[model samples]
Target: MIFSHEFSETSEYSAGTYTTPTDYFRYTLKVFEPGRSVAEPIMTIEEDYAFLMDSQWIAQLPEVREESVSAAPNELIVYFCDMFPFQRSVRDDSTRLLRDEIHNYIHNDLGPGMLEAFRIQSSDWGFIWYGDWTSSRPGADSERLSVALTKNGTWYHGRAPARGHSWISISVEGGVNAYYENLTDGLISAFYHELFHNLQRNMSLELGGNANIDGKEDAWQFFTEGMAVFASSIGMTHVQFSQTTKARAYLAEANKFVAGGGLLDGELNNSYKAMF
Candidate 1:
């Protein structure tokens, strides 16, 4: 629905790595077999068949369905909780997309500048991790995964949330890049955070970000968490923007932005007026 035309799905991982949908479909069809039949199923049967499918397989929903379940085999609904974009531990050394997939998103030509530069060198794997420290929650450890399906959009489907503890519902995430960038309490993981509430745990949880994060607990938390433009921006940091000095610098300039304000406005004109 987000695109004018539907893009094909990315494939599931196979053997040592992931494969695309076209690859898997080609593999499963065996069209080259000598005695294979290739007739398409009748439309009515096809539609009925698709309707009864588990959430994950309901690719495109047809606009119309026949009055009833004419060919359904059973009444049970398939659950796919383990399938959501789930959370997990991501170490620096692991074979994961976070570290490897960054090649897909090229930053500004001059580079992600000092406002919060991501400086991993090309020779150094070009990957950084959205790490986890929940090892003590063995149930929530990385050794296993849980999946489920729920009625969302048009179908019940598999979803994985970014990483966290086991008994806790996963914070849903997907895509090679999105998968690894999630998991932190930081801003870029906002998608992962939402997945945690809606699809994984299905419970509303309290969350803070650029607008609501507190400076007292983490001086950079407010700015890093507060001023970020995108979810991923929350993770950006300036090498020079130390929590200690930066806060004082901000307060020093806030007298003007704060003249009519209680907080550091930092708006260019307002900050200039307050500081000068």
Candidate 2:
């Protein structure tokens, strides 16, 4: 069984308004609270009664868990759907680590960093699906989020719907080991790359970009993918030389491809290579 970890449900939320210093636009957003409690339940009936009766028992209990279940005021709620039962070990190990890494980066690191960088006072909220959207268990918001989902038979590692643009779908088809060469950093960078796409979409609306994103979809692809690629670079920078070396090599290869008339616009136009 998957042990309990901190997670926020989309349902239990407090509404708040976010406004930039420029007063560009006001957004009503939801701040999600963790659905599960962190407190360790007293499994034994005798222990439960003893804990309530004795103050010493409280002191003896372990410190509260450091993992946060609540989404920060300016963050998105992420739900993981493990689609491959055959990859259970992969999910339990590397995938779980990836989940925590993504969680900490988004909620603790990136959100506050964005607020400071943008002079935004209002919170922004959305959801991210970190596994197959189709295989999501009931109540994972899969039904309502039918707007933009990963294409059924398309070859992709990750995508956020360009239309509704609220959620991101990350494909874990071959497990982190096979897909990412067993590199956790590689997995983190990949996830962050897609996450930055969602961020770009949200920030676009916040700063008054066209709501009809598809109308100018071709024009936006360069900037959209560029920002995400840059963001992933930053995400990978913590490891300094290791992943950065590989990423630079990849970028160089892409540069060569672009020099040969490759482009980052539409799916038909070699956009995948450019974005990756």
Candidate 3:
């Protein structure tokens, strides 16, 4: 059996006419074991009260302008916009490079069988304008260039956003040069890393599991990041890997995991330490 709850409210007050009211709620879920005369609660789950609010106001703003390029039916819809002239140039080139690499990796490495299993019919992937990081920018950094998230993920919470089987965002701020000296391989590696994450999420969902949980929500950064790093390195040629420091570093870490027989270890909590 399954159960759920939802709440919503609307107000007719102008911006200053009224103050929003907070609604606190609590709920409990109990599982009972069937018995001849009585049923006893075997498991009881309780949640503390929470003030849930409609967050549509926090959504991503509509794109200033967008341009789409043609791709295979199952391939990504590449959107290039919301960038300054120089950033646009870098994004344009990076988009093309990432598109080709993703296609090749999916077809050659991951294979059509895995693709069919994941049920990824099509993906919408693009680069967005992220201004260069500053001390005042808080958590903004060049590392934000590659990110993949589901429809319900935080990245899609605010503003009008496009819908697709999956959405991958690459930041166009700071330029590719700022992150890596070798532009082509660096962009390719980043794209593949995020692309693998999309695949991981899709595969988990198809298998009747939640990626955020089954994929280790608590230690996600350790496992998924390690897997993505390994994937990014393996997707490219040794020659290309030799040219990119990030790729080389990933390979080194992956090698350590393999060499230490980490895969044979039964300890799940310490697995990430081996990869590191």
Against the true structure, whose lDDT is highest?
3
Worst 10-residue stretch by lDDT in candidate 2? 52-61
What's model 3's overall lDDT? 0.38
The residue-by-residue lDDT of candidate 1 on 78-142, one tens digit each, is 12222222232223324222422322221221112211222211112132121121111234222
Instruction: Show the lowest summed lDDT stretch of 10 residues, model 1.
Output: 197-206
TM-score for every candidate vs. truth? 0.19, 0.38, 0.36
Q: Give each model's whole-structure lDDT.
A: 0.26, 0.35, 0.38
Model 1 quality (TM-score):
0.19
* Candidate 3 local lDDT, residue 190: 48
| Ranked candidates (lDDT, high to low) | 3, 2, 1
lDDT by residue for model 2 (1-276), tens: 333434233223355543322212223323334674435432322211111110000011111111133211222233332222112124455433342254354345433443332222112222322222221223433322211122223322234332112244543333322333333344344455555554454444445664333335466555555556566555555442354324342363255435444444334356555644
Show where candidate 1 strays beyond 4 Å.
1-127, 130-189, 192-218, 227-229, 233-276
Clashes of each: 34, 1, 5
Structure candidate 3, residue pairs in collision: 58-158, 59-158, 59-159, 60-158, 60-159
